[model samples]
Target chain A: MIETKDLRFRYSDTLPFVLEGLNVTIKRGSFVAILGHNGSGKSTFAKHLNAILLPSGGKVLVDGMDTVDEDRLYDIRQHVGMVFQNPDNQIVATLVEEDVAFGPENLGVPQKEIRVRVDEALRAVGMYDFRDRATYQLSGGQKQRVAIAGIIAMRPRCVVLDEPTAMLDPVGRREVMRAIHDMNRTLGITVVLITHHMNEAVDADRVLVIDHGKLLLDGTPREVFSQAETLYRADLAVPQPVELIYALRRDGVDIPGDVLTVDECAEALYHLLKSRTNTRG
Target chain B: MLKDISLGQYIPGTSVIHRMDPRLKIVLTLAYIVVLFMAKGPLSYGLVLLTLGLIIVLSRIGVRFVLRSVRPLLFIILFTAVLNMFHVDGDVLWSWWILKITRQGIETAIYMALRIAMLISGTFVLLNYTTSPIMLTDGIEQLLGPLKRIHVPVHELAMMMTIALRFIPTLIEETDKIMSAQKARGADFETGNVIRRAKALIPMLVPLFVSAFRRADELAVAMECRCYRGSEGRTRLRTLKLQGLDYVAIAIAAVLAAGIITLGVVLP
Candidate 1:
């Protein structure tokens, strides 16, 4: 489990705090998605999880280990691996397999074990075939997958992906999103995905809405998307089908505001239309 | 002179030279240079030119690439040829006041110019038409690995070369973007005096530096996050292998060098 207590951070001594009085607790084995606008402190929070940035006030604890403690910083980081927004920024090695082995090698894993973990990580991300390939020659999605595999090789309990799909095209986005979901469901690894795409958030075990450095909503996907007006006021766009269903219900149609997915929306609409036909008959 | 540098513009292809180990290629380059500089008279010069011509043909690298490599050195060749022509005090074929073109002078000037051109062209054709910068640097690091015993920071040098190679395309792309951004703001790089032109570069330079530093910092953090402490215990995926072809290539170079050296010694 990861927990933060009254976490506050300022970019510098003279600057205003970027994160203010923020408090969040993530449960073990839960896939949580963080949604926020630009400068909403989502990325800043991700950094704190890995001890990449220490809090100026309050504390962050990873698996009950405090990030502020210098001795435990590396230990904390090893538990909470992070994948950044830009795929280009995170990959270190020139070849695909070598890049994956980077983290394990740093931790001084044995050569044989490193090779095993590297191959496993690559295979997990469906990029094992690219082991001998030059990393620079890969596409954005492939590169991001390599970055993800790099983190996975660390075998961290929680993987914090900060908009890993942002720079990718539609196809690339699906590839990364699929891999992130796989890590969450199959591996049972705790995943904290910070993204602006609402559609990407629906499958999360929990959704966190952070606006202007304050927790706006904390609930399951159904509870969060139910509050459509709040999301609009926060300058966040809800998933299209959810928004349409919400607006339709608000206009006195008998649909529900809680249809967070296209398939669910379709099912709900089919039932509503059938009832209307029955009422006419 | 620096601006004219063609730098690492190697073409991609499968050829005998390209297939050889870069370590051997570097060694052969050195050996070839030693032989060429020691070479004297027409016979040795003909052999050197002929060997280079054959390699160029076998490698399938075009004559245009060799010409391009030699183009920038035209002025230097002409100056050296002129100097050798007037300076050599041997059997005169033509004369003027303080200017004499002796048989030895004329021959020496032609041979020197041809040697320099052919030598440069040969090395470049190998470097540019075959080996990649990454492989070249890796080969160099492997070759220089012995220096680590003397505490010479060989790994660091190799790392620096790798990073520099990694950033060249990125920096070029960044500079292009900055130039375009400034152009959008009506900044002209072409229209100004020496001072104005230097000043005009300020906008482009500042952003390029900022972006470069940002990229460097990002790279450092990324590298560190992966636990890259240094070269200690690090291993390579593509280990340097001196293949059968590599040995054959070396033998060929040696034969050429021996032939050239013999011609240089035996010629009148």
Candidate 2:
């Protein structure tokens, strides 16, 4: 679990604060998505989770260990893994299995144990078959999956991913999302996914909207997307289906604004049309 | 064209030579180079050649593939051989204008060329063709471990080498993309004189260097997130343990050096 108390940060004294007076708590084994546009301080917030960037004001505590404690830095990192946007830059090894083993190796895990963790991690991410393949030769999706595997190999209690699918294609995005969901659901690892894609947040247990380093909205996806006007004011957009429903509601079509998926939107429209036809009959 | 750039000439295989401990292979390669220089006459060179041939056979990497390592240096090899042919003075085998060919000069030229070629082939067969770049760096780090006591950053150097090796292909790919992008924007790279051609690459190099630095920064952060603190307390998944075959390899190398030294002493 991660808890941030009035977490505030700025790259330097000359620059303004990137994160300003934000307080949030990420629960253990829960999937949470942090949505924000570019320069919204979401990434700065994620960086503080694992102590990659210390907060200039207030504090970030991971499993009750303060991020500013120099002695517990590695311990905090090992407990909360991080995956970055660019998959190519993050992978340390040329080969697939070796890259996955990199985390455990850095932790000084025993040789036999590292191998088991590497294999298990690769299998969990569906990369076991490509374990011997070269890392660069893989497609974008496969490489991102390998990056996720590298993180999970350390057996972290929580993972904070900063726009992991930003550079990926649609298919790659789906593959990465599926892998993220699997880690959260099957392994019971807490996931804090920072993404601009509203659809990616639809499946999360909680959604936190960050606007100018402030927590603008914090609720379930349905509750957050229902307030489409506020999201637009924050320079964010709801998922496509939710956007459609929002538009229909604005036009006085009496459609629900809480729809988050295509299937749910279609079913709601179908029922509305059936009722209209029944009234005419 | 950039896709063809191979960082290390590693030919993966399950052969005993490929499976040998990389530390042993690196030490043996150094010994092989030393014995190669110690060789003087045809008998000693022939012994070295025989040993190299045995290694090539055991590595299971085809001879033609191994010879590719020497192909890039063909011009230098021939230039040295030709210089040796004319520089040495001895009994004249022939004469044409200022070029007088001596029997000793011809012998030396042939020996020199053969030595250079065999030395390259021997190393290619033993190290590059068998051990992966990661394993090679691992071997170097372990071999240089003692220097750490003298304040040498051997692990850091090896880590740098491994990271550089990992990024070569990625950087090459980026170069290709930048080249194509420049070409699309009407930039010329191939149609001018040497200076013009060199100048055209400035646009390409600038972006490549910028992206590379950015990648380095991001990679450093990623490394820290995975608990990488330095060489201290870090363990490797693949620990190099010397097998029986590795000992046999070292023994053979020792005998080869001994044979070459004996041939030098006895023949002269």
The best candidate in terms of lDDT: 2
Model 1 interface RMSD, one decimal = 2.7
Judge candidate 2 at residue B214 and give its lDDT: 98
lDDT of 2: 0.92
Native interface contact recovery, model 2: 0.82
What TM-score do all the candidates reach, one by one?
A: 0.85, 0.97
lDDT of 2 by residue, B1-268 (tens): 6644544778889998989999998988998898888888878888888898899899888889868889998998999999999989999988899998899999999998998999899988888889988889999999999999999999899989989988999999999999999999999998989999999999999999999999999999999899887888898888989988888888887888899878866785
For candidate 1, the share of real interface contacts preserved is 0.20
lDDT of each: 0.84, 0.92
lDDT minimum window of 10 residues, candidate 1 chain A? A86-95
Scored by DockQ, the top model is 2
